[model samples]
Target: MAFDSSDLKPVGARPPLLDYLVSLWGARHFVIYDARVRLAVSQDHTVLGKVWLVLNPILFGFTFYLIFGLLLQTNRGIENFTGFIIIGFMMFFYTTRSFVAGARSIANGQNLIRGFSFPRAALPLAINVRQALSQLYVLAAMFALVLVVPPSERVGLHWLLVIPIFLLQTVFNWGLGMLFAPLVHKIPDVGNIMAVVTRLWMYSSGLFYEPSRFTDNATILALFHLNPLYQILQMTRGVMLYDTLPSMEQWSLLVVWAGGVWLLGLIAFWRNEESYANERR
Candidate 1:
């Protein structure tokens, strides 16, 4: 058997990166529709429907406050520990959810990838889209909680900065999904591994507690500063609580992480585009 043909293209061939980007742009409507459908399907079984979006996090915040604030007194040094806990958990979970969904995007959509000819990046992009949309409800709940709870942050120009912060985080999530998708596709069980890994990342990312607690140790403090998520969290707290912009240090780290990861992920995932078409279970 011999085969050498320049005229034949693989049936599932992915176009060049620029072509792929153009295809994704063309498929933007599909992405939006798919994301909305997924969110609807996710809530299909829940009796409370959209209410769960607001209720779930509210309950989680109350539980954390009971243990960390009321019992353990984790709020001792903080003025608005109530808002603190909510912001930390809510903000951090956005990225965590993005990671999990992105990791599973390829594996879960293997059927679509094999059966369809669209850009594979669409799947991961849709995951981030779904999350960002859902956050609309969650953030509303968070803001309401902030006002009713102690140490209220008045609404002003500073609060508006959260919009950009969220957009930046979404970019970061998009990159994360791009980075994790191919790896998860190569190892299906890597999805499960990432779950545990992100759990650890959650704790280490300064979502559960303030980083100031570690001021006594330079090493620990520096470690927190290095985490892009922690940087976002600290900046978010400052905005919502104090009406301030991110310090120059935080701004530098955020931009570098978001842009750098996005570029890297785009290239890395593009390299695997053709391979994705053949990845069927």
Candidate 2:
């Protein structure tokens, strides 16, 4: 009560964009280190444990292959159909889990938010890291599937592109987490709606059918390009399975989604930082 105004930390004071980013950069270790620890803790409860990371996507691909590739002959238009399905489904799952995690991050971390004084951004950062780390196993499994599956494709320099592709997706997911974390924190029901949104996203994202199938319909094709998840999955499949560079259009879309969403998310999330501390219910 005796302190001057300078000593009083304003409740809910948001840092400028540049300074907020600097703080996040400085806290990168906390994000990564804590993520690793939490990743382990997060996995301990499940019976199948981390095995599900690799198994789940592979199983999903099998279901898609059974219906689309084998029954409906959706793969008729595409070469290396096995490899294509594997890449599309597995990679799409990464972003799905990332968004789900990000959407739930803030509301789930209320205890920490109420108790700690550290960076609120770190929670979303950690969620992305955890998702990415879990994905490493799945990525490895996908490569193995590519090698063993039909229409065998050789691994080459382009295979190395998975690293950058994953990096872009990770950043994109982090941004999404930032954008939704605050909103969901404020409104608990948003989580239920996000579940439906994610399902529609997966179905429309061309996980099994090639986007080229829609080429006759210019409007539909154009809409597919607008979906960042679709673009990223297309880009990943092009490089890893097709052994060709992604079209400039796909690359540009991924870059824009990754950079634009992450920047917007950070700003939005930070703007509400003060409220997180006092949020109840």
Candidate 3:
């Protein structure tokens, strides 16, 4: 008796896009569990344990505040510059960590990729999820610092806006990770380049100084306005520090960026699915 072969596909063949998405959705439980497990053990061997998650960013923020706010006087005209820098550093680091980890996911997970037949995208998705989980503690530390630091900010209804802003930034970070995962996998050197790139991004993001202070050029200001990370930082500062709601323009721009990058990144990452398993072999 002959069996029908029409429905059969090669073992490693790439699935259609919709099927790929469904498969990824089906694996959501695995992704969440993997993220939780990794997050739990991430600092196991370190002396400080999970405290480092909150401490590390706090230390960085303090150092920057000392140098820029105190010594350099970049905080000259800005109100509550301490809180501004803290929020920028913590939030920006969240994306930086997520992007770098996602970029290295495929290269680092070669063992699992070769051993299993799961959706390749899961690797990066898991990495971003792990970062997002870790970020929660970091954010809590940030808020505490903002409220307790010398020049304290008051809690208000505007602070509620942080929830949506954070969710958008998280989605944007996932999209960014997906966007670069394939490139880094294909060219491992991209990982090194990303380090320098992220540094430049941090500087350009107005982490230590206000952009308006040094520039009046519409073109330059527009470029900053167009940056999604800049928008994220600004919107976060508006609600958390200034007790003001973000403008609708800021909201619209961020929504477009988060949605556009996620859609494009998904397609880009998915197109390279079949190559992932055999790329460097």
- In order, the Cα lDDT scores of the candidates are 0.84, 0.86, 0.90
Q: By summed lDDT, which 10 consecutive residues of candidate 1 come out lowest?
A: 207-216
Better of 1 and 3 by TM-score: 3
How would you encode candidate 3's per-residue C-alpha lDDT over 1-281 as one tens digit per residue?
98999999876578999999999998899899999999999999999999999999999999999999999999988999989999999999999999899878888988988888889889889988899899999989988999999789888887888889889988888888888989999999999999999999998888889999998999998999999999999999989988778999999999999999989888989988888877574
Best by lDDT: 3
Worst 10 residues of 2 by lDDT: 3-12
lDDT of 1 by residue, 1-281 (tens): 98879779876676788988999899999999999998888877888888987788788878887987899776777767888889988888889888889878888887898777788899999999999999889999888888777677688778887888888899999999999889888888888888788888877787767767746688888888888889888888889886777888787889899999888888888888878756446
TM-score of every candidate relative to the true structure = 0.93, 0.92, 0.97
* Candidate 2 residue lDDT tens string, 1-281: 67568766764467777887788788898889988997777757889877877888899889999999999888888888888889998999899898988878888988887776666898899889989999999999999989878777788988888898899999999999899988888888898999899899988898888767756788888898899988888788888877779877777888998999998998899888888877565
lDDT of 1 at 113: 81
- For all predictions, the C-alpha RMSD in Å is 2.7, 2.0, 1.1
**Evaluated with TM-score, which candidate comes out highest?**
3
Candidate 2 regions with alpha-carbon error over 4 angstroms: 46-48
Clashing pairs in 1: none
